[model samples]
Target chain A: MTPIALADYDVVYRRPDALTDVQTHYCPGCTHGLIHRLIGEVIDELGIRENTICVAPVGCAVFAYNYFNVDGCEAPHGRAPAMATGIKRVIPDRVVFTYQGDGDLAAIGTNEIIHAAGRGEDLTVIFVNNANYGMTGGQMAPTTLAGQVTTSSPYGRDVDLVGMPMRVAELISTIPGASYVVRRSVHNVANINKTKAAIKTAFQVQMAGLGLSMVEVLSSCPTNWHMSADGALKWIEDAMIPVYPLGDYRVADAVEPLTKRRRPDRSQNGSLATIPEE
Target chain B: MAKELWKGNEAIAEAALRAGVEAYFGYPITPQTELLEYMAREIPKYPGRVFLQAESELAAVNMVYGAACAGVRVLSSSSSPGISLMTEGLSYIAGTEVPAVLVDIMRGGPGLGNIMPSQGDYFQMTKALGHGDFHPIVLAPSTVQEAVDLTYGAFELAETYRTVVVILADGAIGQMMEPVVMPPARPVMTEQERADWALRGAKDRERRILTSLHLSAEGLERMNQGLQNKLARIQQKELRWQETMTDDADLLLVAFGTAGRVCTSVVSAARRAGLKVGLLRPISLWPFPEQRLVELAERVQQILVVEMNAGQMVLDVKAAVAGRAPVHFYGRMGGVVPLPDEISAQIDKLVSEPAGGTGFKTGSNNGYGQPKAMPAANGVRA
Candidate 1:
């Protein structure tokens, strides 16, 4: 009798083809899996799975090379931007990207990421900001918020001793080579959809031959943050967003047209439809 | 097409370009700054080539790691301090088994040592450049011409073994100007050639992931053993040394790089003075030419090891001789180069010594064993 109502349902969820069929090592409530899925979906949608290369950073995402179905290589801690720059410059046609964690990007790799952005390397960077060093246990990362308690900063983070937390997206946006720098989050379905869109736009910026593009996603770290999965998601909304606001920090003129064309109405068919006169 | 006068650093940079290097990532450091400059100037002339002045030596080495992983010839250069910054990257490159060139125009150092010519990196290059049990194929060049030839061939050897190869030069060699003929240009790997191993894309095959982190102890042990085997093969095939007058001489001098050049001049003068003096220069410091050293020790009465450092290579020479002959050492450290006369004077002193032969001896026992006297030749010390 219940079969009569089955016609009302529609297919709405499926795994991205660019992701391998394997279990992730990320802990429950961790957002790395979501971010990985978003990137895989972006690669699948853009039809770049076979022409894409990824440089996995050294932090928690060191084994990300195993998760992505595209060809990849491991970059030593904090050197993904420089590594991606080298790969992109050598083979400009390939769609190269780097996936990095907050500690890897804002701490040991600050110089590399900054230099790569300043050089306007044509690549996409997915920067996950969890505010703590997850790979080596809960250490005080460069992005650790002021007054936030971490294993290394057990006394609630002395601002006088160590500097305030870094705002990576805003800082990166100041570089002239960066064409698109946006800060997004992945918690609920709506926010997750927005994160996916931001990643796709970053990839589009690369495909369009624009300058460097990066998307900084405020992700949850339940294990390191000492919170349950739901609590961590709530913490990102209540605590993290106030310090690191979510918004597009830079959308250079070269990427504006692509962003406009990326809207759903124009992206449906194989060809991009010209906008009608207003 | 005549030979041109080029600085040691610039010549190495040009030779890398001609050897089909497609990417160059380097940081500016004393003695080797000209090399980075030359790359910046020349890379633009070649299409598809990349030249990036990295933020630091660490970044530069990692950039080479990335380019090398993509199956292209790439390299980086640095001075002593800068090369020290690259130690971690070098170890990672070794663990990943990626092919690339590292040029170290060594300066004096244990820490921020002066930018003068020094052979202080002999142990760093041969024994351990970074954490882990791995060996890089180290090439020592004594002349600008040899520098060009060695730099040109370094890329090939690196690719053949899928390991890092070092061109170990001193500050003086990097700064000196000498005539050198650049090797003929070779084409960079074609797209098809690179596709064989490069992480360019997974279009025709399964995805490839280049990594060095093997978490399991057994997995890492296997990787270590594989690296050991590769090193053993290189040692067997790439031992290079030059023997001058050692066939009929009673006294032999051991040196490398600029120190070796000075020793050659000393040998010429000693031969003119009716002294049976000869020279043996090691071109590959890591493989070390130990077999050849043993052969020469069997024939020579005494061996004198000279260098710009206090006494680095002497230990190696002593081990190879293994008490077969007495080994004496003379050196000038702290950026001071030992002049040919200074080395010749030491040679004269050793030749004039009594039957004990300068009291520096290592026989059949290992390096740490007790030293014994060299056998007297015709009851006199040869």
Candidate 2:
């Protein structure tokens, strides 16, 4: 028998309070909405909503300042890390992070991100990789997959012409300044859970003053991919995952033990878990 | 509070430190590297102060944008080319109304010209500093002590107006040494106050987003109009200049920065020759001391505009004179510092023919190398 009452069951999920009630402008099936929710959820769990500053990059997420209910400023395309560095260095106690997309982080901003990472700036970086430029009408991005077709790569991405897709996580992990670096996907429920855990670890890395930390989440852009929402999710699992494998490429030894157990108060049951000190 | 002999660059750096600057980020460029180096040496002395030699001018300015937006007193210094690289960031800072200080120890150039001194950046600093309809408070100091004072005052002005304040110094000033009585350090914005103005976590207040990008035409118009009003207020309240011997003079020498200092000697020499010559040194170049210049133009028989470049500020002087007094220009171009004797000669010539026409006149050794024939346009001479 079908239940007539919608409020018959306990509340299982809802939007994070850290996120504004205003609807975001993200296109349908764009995983940016999911990524924003995870970030908001993490900020809510840490109770750092009031003390958080998000540097919104210039891309599809350029208006991220409006999306998050935290103090933020827009950075010139690819300069979010530099701005975050300024904010954190000026006010060290405040939590600061940069939200950037594939084109924003890997293209024009390559020099800035690399230098920011090399300096071991105490900030978090949330990078979204969708293989193509979602903004400016699907141009070939630095992270565009080999043989992937886009407006700039009308004849499919030519490895010989444009080189292989940049493995940002792998490149960043090589830097000694990067204390924690991980790549995760949000294509499925299981992977989405891992991605949230990685995001939490990135924040913890900053909390411990363990230097720069980054989480690269493989996202799907159904509109830019010219595929249905379901097909784009399938492509992320089949094509994107194989190219950018999911793993923790660099977790400094000091960070290893910290990630083992969760903070008790940060439970998902709407109750404070026993936060035991390690 | 004791007097100490300091180079202009070093004086500016010490002044910024005393002004309670929380952070200093810059990239090394000629004539201004000492300023950066001084910060590197001194920042370690203060607890919680930050100093960084950025990877590039682009990065340095963006970092400044961040620090400024966060409601802290911050600064950066560079030469002509480096400041050019920073113009884009400066535009963003202006649009967002972020308070910050930028120092330019000018050398020659449209490109990587030279390490020698030149006032060629006058138009660049006063008129077209950055894109969009924004104007920064441009201060030009002649001596090391004045450099220290202007640099110290610039921080306060930036905070007061919530806008960028530029200390436009020449390479000569940056390299020269003079005694300066440094200002005592005053209290700066507290962390809480800074966070209140900055995007320092929206923990206690509604989220504040510092941005220059306004999509709505009406919204952008309001922001731009607000900036214009601020600039108008700054122009009215902050016009600074020094007049020496202009009371009964038939000739007035108008100059600023190092060139203005040189004109002091020229004025004295012209007076020794029994000519009533005076000097008007503008301490604030952007405000241009136009109102005072207009008043002085009525009394003086002729005005001699002297500089180290191909006549930039003279245009402003001419505009201020507005045909009441004929304005003649004598300048050395491309980093060549004009000699007092040559400036005196120009003063003598302009005074000798008080009713003469107005045009540019090149001094010997046009800040470049050897002198060339001048473009003889309407009494213009080399």
Candidate 3:
């Protein structure tokens, strides 16, 4: 048992101070936990844990208020954007954000999200797109892919009847108020790292006072999807990404320098690839 | 300044602004559109105050909810159909125990009824604005001046109780112009004052969480009990009503808002005609002045309830009377404002008809013949 060198092995994990020391209610193999950790890490990296306020939506992430160590409030159904806009307007210096799900954002809250983006509200939005309503037991969400089977759409979705699934990232990017709108997946190591970078950049967009920034992350609900954890992750790559493509839909010129500076020297203090807002 | 004529909606907006409203969110709806319009014009004049014309009433109410959680004096206004869309937001505001004020200049509706004035929201405001075990503190204003005063004080009441305050006026009060003496301006709530409960990014303090959802039944039940206790305390301390000539009276008139304003003339005319008739106009509709109704019931021979709705508040009046006196109601629905003469005639009909007023007798201004439509007149409101 020779003494290992300090840098001999890779570090498995370091908990973000922005997260509370409690068990999360998320299911096993769910990407919600991974995404939450990314947000926590971003908050820590930016030193904005004390100044960030989150508006949690009314889906599976309704209890997001409990996991985050930062200040938060709950918005009814698809109303996080409206709620976050309110907090930001009253206290413009504060960093305000909303954590929403597919059913909450793409379904009931389309109007609020669209209006908030259209208003060019200075806010960050982390939209978790998992095809169906996970909390309500796999109902057909507005983001449900065509030919996708769900509890409400047992015989696969009918494009003629219900129409194609909404491409939220692309749709929101079309709004003039949108400064940085991107879609990423959290199914694998490479995509997960990209998702984290996207989350950090979106927050930077808010801190930069550019415009409304949102990252629509393609996630999995293995329990609801009736698949094992690994299968669900694979499903996101195989099925979900085609219907909801991953990439930047809108990027303001002001945010390009921040993304261009991505992880140029990650060995330098931290793995987070964010430039501090001046 | 000396009393100046002000439109009801605009005056309420001005009063709310003077009450230190930092943010005002609302949708454009008839009867109350002028309130939102005035906010749009006036709020931006201030350096930091906010006025947003939300996409809909739902958005407006939620904006109010968000601002309230931030611990600012925020308000929104709408008429009936618009207010109906705000119930969910109002419920969340209530459950979160954050203060918010809403001015509902009611219009006729169970659904998009009309733009004319009506008291159809009697149940909606006092009993259930949304799905919850909570009642908002409701203040009814009968005149432009009263609307100004109530709208000004609504902020303080909401913040003091950490609950929702609804200023319940109607289209007649909103659309009509009358003399109003505006109150002196109050300083907007400083962020320092909101340090206790508001979520201003949790700088230099522990994180704050405001939400209405309680996952466990026990947790929700406790929250419900807490809300119930707050309401009960409000009921004990905040009963408000105006009594006109109830000392020596045989016939007592009960009403609120526009109908109550018209009842004043009815009382004066009856007194001039050598009748001892008094009026009890409830200013607070939720606490409802039930105790005073009981006291008045002890002295009066007959109690006549007048309202613009077909008979909503009369039910409450009857329950308060509790067989103490014969309770009779006369009302006009579908946006018809009841006239002083019509109310006076109904009082005569009630006294002449029977000795025992056990069951609630509902009479209409429309004679039994054919339910003919009356011209939508401004009537006493003008």
- What DockQ do you compute for every candidate structure? 0.77, 0.79, 0.81
**Model 1: docking quality category:** medium
lDDT of 1 by residue, A1-278 (tens): 45757568553556777899999999998999989998988898889999999999988888898999999999888989988887887888999999999999999899999999998989999999999999999899988989999999999888899988999999999998999999999977768877878898899899888989999999999999999999999999999999999999999988877666533332432222224334
DockQ of 2: 0.79
Predicted structure with the largest lDDT when compared to the true one: 3
True contacts kept of 1: 0.81
Among all windows of ten consecutive residues in candidate 3 chain B, which has the lowest summed lDDT?
Answer: B373-382
Candidate 3 lDDT over B235-321, as tens digits, reads: 999999999999987788999999999999999987776667899999999988999999988787677888888888998988887
lDDT of each: 0.87, 0.86, 0.88
By TM-score, the better pick of 1 and 3 is: 3
Interface RMSDs of all predictions? 0.9, 0.8, 0.7
Question: Which CAPRI level is candidate 2?
Answer: medium
The interface root mean square deviation of candidate 2 comes to: 0.8
Model 3 CAPRI quality:
high
What value does the lDDT take at residue B30 in candidate 3?
A: 93
TM-score list, all predictions: 0.93, 0.92, 0.94
Per-residue accuracy of model 3 over A119-235 as CA lDDT, tens digit each: 999999999999999998899998988988999999999999999998999999999899999999999988888988999999989999999999999999999899999999999
